[model samples]
Target: MSELNALHDLLKGLGDEVVRSGERIVGRRNADWSGIPAVPPLAVLYPRTTREVSQALSICHAHNQPVAVQGGLSGLAGGGCTQAGDIALSLERMNTIEDIDEIAATMTVQAGVTLQTVQERAHEAGMMFPLDLGARGSCTIGGNLGSNAGGNRVIKYGMARAQVLDLEAVLADGRIVGGVRKMVKNNAGFDLRNLLIGSEGTLGVITRAVLQLQARPGSVATAWCGLADFDRVTALLRLTRNRLATGISAFEVMWPGYYEYVLANVDGLRAPLSARHGCYVLLESVGGDPARHQADFEKVLQDCLEAGIIEDAVVAASDSDAREFWNVRDAPTAFPILMPRLIAFDISFSIADMGRVSQDCVARLGARWPGSTVLVYGHLGDGNLHVIVDIVGASDETVLQVEAMVYGLVEEYAGSVSAEHGIGLKKRGVLGHTRSRADLEAMRAIKLALDPRDILNRGKIFPDELLTRRMND
Candidate 1:
């Protein structure tokens, strides 16, 4: 019998658990939110338990069958995407909240649990799961850890990796390593849990996690302010931090083009400011005392406005109003529906270089693609900016050119190629621009040690030939 046929026979006992039909796995095995075309895997495997996952990987390891691990399929990068002859492993069945310790302020959950579920559960327990993102309803905790995701709350709660106290993962060789620690301090030895958290499933398959939780904020305040320029925006950030300190939760910024595009394109969303400006900032503060928090927020806004630091400002009068203010900044519907053919970018740079980099981006994109539009906005509080280039009828060549131009600017500004998003197939080629030669070599060494067969998320982070060429160059 052929290898494929033999593999199928060896796994036939899985029955309905093993998805063999092509039609059923159409969108199931694809990477989350990625625009890349999906390659049908040999089969999409569903393992309900860690041991089951180990069993499947053991069989695949023996047969040398490559595997791609997928969670919510909500990732922009193609790291979770499947290739030919690869078996896709979906963690959907493993969704469960294993434990929620109110006294300890921690939650132990299966990797397949959606972030939204975790958040809601934590809220019900009078705690907050601080790791939140736009894809919370769809993205899984495992994927969040795999990508080391950061969202609006990251400025306050840190990344997904920070929120995690301990985790459990299945190795490429089907060895289950469980380290579900609940203690706040364990300074005994090396942190093996961190190795798999942001490894993008290239090192091991994450199955469960023990996440640290924070006390639910009793007071939440939001404000929308229009800024004269990036300098004022930074000043506002510094002032907010200096005054409000740890109470500040979010500080989102949008350039004129991005603010205007979303304002014009997204229906039912109105601008908070009366007049257009060069920049817009949405700030949120959370604290234990509602009255004190609101007073501090208003005082800062009023002081900034009186001091000529801000052009205009509006504090959210109610929860609904705050949601509306954020809707404009989020642009959840605008970007996907209106600008369907845009190249999205998420890079981190120094706060000081933002204004120049954004101006250079707009100028360069316009010079090259005469009619193209560049939209800029992001979590400015953390220096992670999101850029979208809208070029009409852009071809493959045009995409390559635009990517190089954008990433080139990021490199010029001494920025990272990717901020929240992992280095999937999309950003694999340009990773050298951000990472050093020694760093790349060390990462490659880890990948080789963990996955000698190269069976896990192959061709996601860094390609061999490209790494060698970059090192040589």
Candidate 2:
């Protein structure tokens, strides 16, 4: 077929080690992580260096071949999909740790480095990589920055983009742009790194990056506290932050229903404490001194109890115990395995409006689907909440109805439909609810000017109607 011949020639052009076509799996995985996997691509290009990436992209641009830039393929959004006739450019072979600037407290790494590898390697060198998540073992630095990922410690260390210093990416036209040097203070021009960080590889392909590091933590204190209501949780957060200062790194909240669901279904896990509380908070504090940190933690707990801000609290006494305390809140394996397919969403609202919006959303979900179970929880300190609506044995129409109800109410509350995950293929239709017309127009213009051929991850971020059908598609 002409398609095979064309793909073979493109691969041959890249070099013997760079390309592969037939009988090979390429493109991004589906949203469910399996169902409806993206249609196979014309070829998969695995470039090992910046120059190779440029040349391969240049060829694709010249041919007007739609290409998807993939890092770890761990993204939940379908940003990396490619149908027949399209191509995939993976940074898999580009893994490398170029340097770790100890003096500057920064590390420069290629985009393909696994996040967990960075964390462990940096820890071994007596530094800390604060950005972490359940998927760190598989996710890549570029993927993290692409989604502006916010994990457990986001309440303290900020998002992935905040922890980054600089980056190097190849634009759609095969032009390399951005700086790689570590700069803490640069007012010379626009903050270009921020633009590339959360773009989901739509505007360009991330090749290399420099990340900011923090001092190795000397002490850690974790606790699972029970709260009478969300108001108390907010008050508890304020009280702890006021007392502990910046030492508070993680503040995770869980609604009672969620905790109960996990305990009922998850094996090898028991409810550490009674599951009757209206709300539960998992708080962690990291500091430079162990003794003082532990004392301060207890004192804060006692103060909160006396002030009626907290009902009950159990502080972890050992490292193993601390992880045990967090497992209940962090693991979502049980939810998906035991419950029916749920419409899960991560929405961010101002801290002040969290209680009202969550309550209204829950009431609406219950009314819309009586059999559906609604659970709400999140990082209270950061104003980002995770909501799940379970539609057990529901029809496709029912599932869509629940989604409409949740997202529609979220917009009314002025909350983001996606707090950290990029729009990608999954949320393209709902993007208008989150971004304004002017915002999307500017984004489209930037995509056009930089990748005029529409060769870089085409038909993503923007809707499908915006583009004329690819001649070959």
Runs in model 1 lying further than 4 Å from the true structure: 1-6, 9-29, 464-473
Off by over 4 Å in 2: 1-9, 24-36, 465-473
In terms of TM-score, how similar is model 1 to the real structure? 0.95
By summed lDDT, which 10 consecutive residues of candidate 1 come out lowest? 464-473
TM-score against truth, every candidate? 0.95, 0.95
Candidate 2 has its poorest 10 consecutive residues by lDDT at: 27-36
| CA lDDT, candidate 2, residue 455 | 79
Q: Judge candidate 1 against the unseen true structure and give its global Cα lDDT, from 0 to 1.
A: 0.85
Model 1: per-residue Cα lDDT at residue 256: 92
